[model samples]
Target: MSAGPFKVCMLGDFGVGKTSLVSRFVRSTFSDKYMTTVGVKVDSKEVARPGRDPTKLVLWDIAGRNAIDSVSANYLRGASALLIVADGTREASLAAALNLLMQARGLLPNAFAVLAINKFDLLDRWEIAPPTLTQLRRAMTVFETSAAAGSGVEEAFAAIVAGLDP
Candidate 1:
């Protein structure tokens, strides 16, 4: 397959830091201010692969609607990958992320999916259990990320790009 400007949809519940994750990965910047994504926000980043041309990932940061309704499904159209995020401080958000992943898979069966449990910096307040992480690992590549601290941000993006390699 060609090194494409692949469409990667970012899905999660509200306040999961989808925007922050994207900002940190794409622009190497993070902000404390919370801004709800209206409709969808589009951003692009070129990821380097060894011995191949860089892959351009066109990231679609979708609004944090827990359910995949008609409007959300439309925004996810043509996606080749997904970055499903969840707030580590909120266990319910993790469940929501998983559900969103399921819905996204139903829509785009072949799209590469990666799970990111954000806010790793706040480990003290983390609620996700080890067994849960282990279970998730059996399904998809899981990364603990901190958008504020810029941890695992690049690796998560790179892993998705690598997964897209054919």
Candidate 2:
């Protein structure tokens, strides 16, 4: 199978673990620190799909949006796909994630998106409602990921790569 290169942008709210998620998926590492991403941080990973060729995912971890309206749409212009992340323990993050997804999709109508609700390892303290999960799932391919515990991260990344078909 021939390898294809795709640019995938990561979207979410501040402190929703966007950086950590990318770090975990790309470097197999995680940190509990809360550092802000200024503009866009790019990382690369080669993913193998089951019946298809490997894909080179150029993940662009965009800066967390204060609101969907404030996002720089230009940052998402060339993206082939998206990974909208949310924090499971913060209900507002999920709301923000949805809003971000909506706005980003509108900007790049052709880009495929995956909803990633991060910090799933803290499900015991999760504050998001069932209806919220239902909404996100209905919206796109959703993944419950934990960068700290390294759960569901690979699947989420793989899901994005598998979806990058021409």
Candidate 3:
């Protein structure tokens, strides 16, 4: 809305599918091969907001790691929002995602943020217990996404855009 470009950073644990989610949302593609992001891969997609105009989201796919240092501050310099992701099949990644969320909020206190639990296509192997999900939900706006199936990916991105003022 307001017809302006907004930067949104994707922060999460390594192999949590941050790149895949970005690919799916921006390019409508998903790759099975695991590729660790070196620094940040920027991508853009325009999303329409409910009862408002569209906005261009410059998605900053920050390098994922167990710690926030893996993400260069340069990449977060102008971010307007955050998408903190976790691997559903790996419970530990959830912790890392929360850590990244805290770091992002600390750096950009006024920015909107989302907690995404990725790899939903692998539902059979999901290791995140219900209690954890509840806890995560209380912590942030949580989404269960499957980049491989294109489920919830669009909504996740659109939600961030909608959070911006019109």
Choose the strongest candidate by TM-score: 1
**Candidate with maximal lDDT:** 1
Steric clash pairs (candidate 1): none
Candidate 1 lowest-lDDT run of ten: 46-55
Q: How would you order the candidates by TM-score, starting with the best?
A: 1, 3, 2
Judged by lDDT relative to the true structure, which candidate is superior, 1 or 2? 1
Task: Quote the positional error of residue 77 for candidate 1 in Å.
Answer: 0.6
TM-score of each: 0.98, 0.91, 0.93
Q: What tens digits encode model 2's per-residue C-alpha lDDT throughout 46-111?
A: 887787767688888888984555446878878888889999998888888888877777888888
lDDT of 3 at 95: 85
Tens digit per residue, CA lDDT, model 1, 1-166: 7579899999999999999999999898999999999999999988899889887999999999788999999999999999999999999999999999999889999999999999999999999987999998998899999999999999999899889995
Report, for every candidate in turn, its global Cα lDDT versus the true structure: 0.94, 0.84, 0.85
Scored by lDDT, model 1 comes in at 0.94
* Clashes per candidate (backbone, < 3 Å): 0, 0, 0
- By summed lDDT, which 10 consecutive residues of candidate 2 come out lowest? 66-75
Listed per candidate, the RMSD to the true structure in angstroms reads 0.8, 2.1, 1.6
